[model samples]
Structure formats: structure tokens, C-alpha cells
Target: MAETEKSGNAFVETIKTIVYALLIAGVFRTIFFQPFWIPSGSMKETLLIGDFLFVNKVAYGYSYASCPSLRLQRFGIDVDAKDICGFFDGDNTRLFGGEPERGDVVVFRHPVSGRDYIKRLVGLPGDRVQMKAGVLNLNGRPVEVEDAGTFEEVMEPQGPQRIRPRCANGAVGDGGMCIKERQIETLPNDVQHTILNIGPQRVDDTGVYTVPEGHYFFIGDNRDNSLDSRVPAAANGVGFVPYENLIGRADRIMFSSAGRSMLFFWTWRGDRFFKAVQ
Candidate 1:
């Protein structure tokens, strides 16, 4: 009887230990850092579709929005009087922190949808932003871009052909036919990064956008592909993101997988492990 009692006690103790460990981990994750997975190819070469990265919570300080524990209290503005969750409306305060600088890749809450979004900070408050024929113009000055060579993606095999060509010029000229224009773009602050131009898309040219106060303009490195601040909010694009919705900056990639399934060990991208997000 004593032996059985002791065994039961040991099991209870083990469960208690696990619960405590989980609580500690949850608190740490809520306060200091959060993990995010890249769900799309918007950032492209800078951040791949299968990349997993860490967002430093302390980078912009703590806010009601930053704590997962307080998610229920995070309110949103009513898009229309008929919308659900329209009753709750107010702004959360961000305590102690600085604003994001140009070229910093950040994660924030979408203004309308309340979904999380990650993009590069291109324009600050009160900066004039425009894209004229694939070129980015900030405050009336054009950003400098230099050719950085071609960026190619291997097309999925269809039937007998193992590798298919999908170049920029046509349907299939050569194995490396469908090429994207890659260039090194330097921001006004001297922060340099690579951007991809996939020909003249809808957002390649845009009218002048004067950024309002307390809001920032964001864009993706995949210029021709991203639906960023260039697109209007009415069109389902992220408009000028407010300061209150700011989350944190992505510091580095923790791990990456070429294949979406994590169960496949062979699909692990060893090269991107611990790679810093520039």
C-alpha cells in the first residue's frame, strides 16, 4: 500500500514540475521574445516561405498588444457599424520604447483585419512616398538601386522534365529563362539591402503618398509582388500602419525548412539556421 502511494505521489510531482516549467516558458515568451513563421513569399530572398524567426518584444518595449496574456483586451476600431466585435474600440498604450528606423523589418498588427503582418519600414511619419516606374521615391529623392544579378526559383517538375524554365521574358526559353531582376537598394540612412523586381506589375508605379503623422509606410523587398502601403486599405492592402499596432522587429532566423512539413529531416535548410535578418 505504501509503495503504491509513493508511486502516485511521484506522478503528481512530475505533473506539477511540468506545469511549472510550461508557465515559466510562457512568461518568457510573452515578455522577451516571440516566434513567427513566414507564411508567404512577400519578403522573398530576405525571408523565405518556410523561415522561422524570432521577434524581440523588448525592441519596441512592452504594450498591451505585445503580451499574449492580454490579447482579449486588445481592441480594434469598428470598420463598419455592422461588423462583428464593433463594440470594442480603443487604443492600447506602448510603454517605454523607440520608433522603428528605416529598413528595419518589423512585425505589426494589421489596421483593419487585426492580423499580424511583417514588412520592411520604408517611410517614417510625414515622409512623402511614391513608386514611379519601379523606382522608390522618398521625400522627393529617388532611392539608389544597383543591379545585383538574377534571382531564379526552381519550378516544380511536371511530367518527364525534371527542371522547368520560367524566365521573365517568356513561357520557357532556357532552364534559367524566368529570371527576376535583383538589385541592391540603399536607403537614405545608408542601410543597404537587396530588392527583387519581377517586371512591371500593378504596384510598379504609384501616385504620391504623403504619410500622415504617427504612422509609418512599409514595403516588401519583393517590390513588384508585395501589397504594402502602396495599396489602399479599401483594396485590402496594409495602409499607413499606426504606431500603436507596432509589435517588434525580427532580429534573426531561428531555423528554416525548404519543405513546409517539419517532420521531414532531409528538407531542413542548414544554411539559414541562425542567420541574421538584415
Candidate 2:
């Protein structure tokens, strides 16, 4: 009888230890950093579809979305506390130092849909932004851009259907099809980043957009394919992202896989392992 009691106590102790460990891990993830997997080619070349990255939660300080109290509603736990944790100009935790700068690749919550979106900061507060024939123009001046080369990636099958190497950039003939033209872009802050100029998409030409106060403009490295600030939120684009919606900056690629899902370990991209997100 004593032996049975001892064994039961030991099992209870083991379960308690696991529960404590999980609670600690959850707290850490909610406060300092968060892991995100890229599921789309919106930020391709810079961030591939299968890339896994850690967002620096302390980079821009904490916000309402970063607070655990805000997430309680989902678990049937209600907290009447106001949403005022993460703010730059207002009172905030100020855990770290840094603000979003032009050319910085960041991850933020979509203003309308509340979905997480990643893109490069292109327009700062009060900056005039526009695009002319696929070339980016800021503050009445055209941004500098130079041709890099071509980029090609396989479009894997969806479910049981197979995909062919169709023209991705809307190019004619067999030569210009199935590949995207790369270009090196220099932002106003002198931050250089790569952009994919695939085809003459609708956003290739747009009217002047004067960024309002406390808002920033973002665009994708894949110019023609991304639905970013150039498009309105009502139209399914991110629209002008508010400062409070900012989450964190993407620092590096933790891991990468080319498979449709992570279960396909055979499709792991070994070369992109631990690659710095430039």
C-alpha cells in the first residue's frame, strides 16, 4: 500500500512540473518574441513561402496585441482592462528601443482584417508616395532602381492538381515567361533592398498618397503581386497601417522548407537555415 501511494505522488509531481514548464513557456512567448511562418510568396526572395522567423516583440516596445490580457477573451477569460499597453507616443512598457524605419521589413497586424501582414516600410509619416510605371516615387522624387536578374521558383501542386510553369510576370513568348525580373531598390533612407518587377500590374501607376499622421506605408518586395498600402483596406489591401497595429521587426530566418507543409521534412531548405533576413 505504501509503494502504491509513493508512485501516485510521483506521477502527480511529474504532471505539475510539465504544467509549470508550459505556463512559463507561454508567458515568454507572449512577452518577448513570437514565431511566424511565411505561408505566401508576398515577400518572396527576401522571405520565402516556407520561411520561419522570430519577430522581435521588444523592438518597438509592447502594445495591446502583445499583451497577454488582450488574448484572454479567446480562452473564455474576460479582462476589463483597457487596451493601452503598446504605444510609442503614449504611455507604454518601453521594454526596448527602436522605431520602424524605411526599408525595414516588419510584421504587423492588418488594420481592417486583423491578420498579420509582413512588408517593407516605404512611406514614413507625412511622406508623399506614388508609383509611376512600376517605379516607386517618394516626396516628388523617383526612387533609384537597378536591374538585378531573374528569379524562378516552382509552383508546387495544390492537393491533387499539378501546376505548370506559366508566365508569372505576364510575359509573352517562352523566354520571358515563368520567371520574375529582380531589381535593387534604394529607399530614401539609403536602405537598399531587392524588389521583384514581374509585370505591368494595376499598381504600376497610382495617384499621390499623402501618408497621414501616426500611419506608415508598406509595400512588398514582390511589387506586382502584393496587396499592400497602395490598395485600400476596403479593397482587401492593407491600406495605411496604423502605428498601434505594428507588431515587430523580422530579424532573421530561423528555418525554411519548400514543402507545402512542415510534415514533408524531405523538402527542407538546408541552404536557408539560419540565414539573415536582409
**Off by more than 4 A, model 2:** 68-97, 158-177
lDDT of candidate 2? 0.77
Per-candidate local distance difference test:
0.78, 0.77
Which 10 residues in a row give candidate 1 its minimum summed lDDT? 80-89
- Count of steric clashes across candidates, in order: 6, 2
TM-score of 1: 0.84
Model 2: lDDT of residue 263: 76
Q: What lDDT tens digits, residue by residue, belong to model 1 across residues 138-250?
A: 99999999999988876543222232323465564433435678899999999988898767777888889998887889999877767789997778999898886777899
